[model samples]
Target: MKWFKKYHLELLLVLPMTFYILGFTLLPLIRTIILGFQNRYTGKFSLSTYQALFARPDFLKSISNTFVIALLSLSIQIVIAFIIALVLKQRFHGRSIIRAIVLMPMGIPTIVSGIIALYVFGTSGYFNELLFKLHLITKPINWLTGNFKGLLIIALADMWKVLPTLVLLLLAGLDSISQDIYEAAELDGANSWQSFRFITLPLLKPTITMAVLLRAVDVFRIFELPQVLVGKSVPFVSTFAYEEYDIGDLNGSGAASTILLLMILVFAILWLKFVDRGGSFGNDS
Candidate 1:
């Protein structure tokens, strides 16, 4: 009774969050895992659902497409976000206005962004129209036709929507860095490139890893942009699972969902290991 009384306020603060996680996150994850291993009809243990899922050619394609989109989008986002963050870190006239403009896309709805992408890239879209007006092309260029082209467009569209969030994260990381270090490097006659390569990049490693991990996980589950832009013509793991669910293949959907969850888990583990090894190497150096 005395112990409870002493920690009562802390218990009150934590209990609700603990319960929420159990009720919402943990319960759902346990249920999904169970469903993945169970037969949909008899509710008996079986591997048939997983077998069927892997036998489908589209499922394999979806897995590949997921990786392609993730890599492309994340590559574009990180590079652009880093550059933008660096620029935004510097003080200039109307800097606040530029930052607000840069972050505006983060506030837009995903569906809305998808639609905007379609308008710009579709058959009668603004891009082809502009090219035609410029006499650059006599016919409308189908930008989202081939697998590479379609996937590239989807990746770019996703980047546009999510880039602002990454920029904010990197900007925060940059802000945490001390200006004194930069001034000291300048005084020691280190050039901009040398200072950035040695000081900024190394110090920013943890933040970069965090931003990449979060974005990679999110990108792996991409659905809406591809769904809106090209439908199931370009499949992602999330979309594949949704398609199974839509078609009443509950067990297959569960299997796909399980695979996706495992993929994310493995990727996260590998990333953490790589980061740990890199940290050790730095220490040794």
Candidate 2:
């Protein structure tokens, strides 16, 4: 009875979370896999759905587009966010105020961010006006009309919305680094770039792994920004899946979703494995 009383609080706290995850998250995932495996109308197991899924040329284009957008945007955002994080870490006047301002985007939802992007990038928007006024162009350039340009606008909007959170994550990792190590490196005649490369990045592997994996997974499944900004004109996997499900092709949607899930899973597994092989998380460079 004493043991029961002691552990009951822990059990009560954990059981609800466990049940919620099982009921809502894991079950849905299993159902999705099963949905993807089933034939469209026959309700029998078959590979025909996936075969048809891959047979479409536009579907292939969407997959390729997703890869290009995800890799390019993530690479650009990480570099920019890390640089901003480094600057924020330096002691300076009004640093807190600057940080708060930079992090303002955290409160802006993706849908709202999409609206903002349209306001700023639309033909009648500030970007076109600025270019026209500066005599950089003869007329308002149609930025979203081109495929690469549309993807660029979407990527920029996503980066703006998510960069603050990434910077904060990197800052936390930066803070966890012992200053004594940097001081020792300075004593060894290391310059700024050398010190960062030798001490900062190596120590930041785990946190980088954490931040990148979280952001990569979320951004790779991007839908709202593209949907709100350009709608079906953009060929993202998420948008394609939405179209499939909208047309009452549940199995087709499931197959697209399964492919996207596998893409993310593979990237996550590779990232984790790479991080693990770089020695223990607690080891400082």
Tens digits of per-residue lDDT for model 2, 220-261: 899999899888777788999999999999999999999999
Put down candidate 1 lDDT per residue, 1-285, tens digits, no spaces.
999999999999999999999999999888887888888889999987888778989999999888888888888989999999999999999999999999999999998899998999988899999999999999997887888889989888888898898999999989989999999999999999999999999888878888988998988988888889888887888999999999998878888888899888887788778754455334545
**In angstroms, how far off is 49's CA in candidate 1?**
0.8
Which candidate achieves the best lDDT against the true structure?
A: 2
Model 2 score (lDDT): 0.89
Against the true structure, what is every candidate's RMSD?
3.0, 2.6
Each prediction's TM-score versus the true structure: 0.91, 0.92
**Model 2 weakest 10-residue run by lDDT:** 275-284
Model 2: which residue pairs collide? none
* 228: Cα error in model 2, Å: 0.9
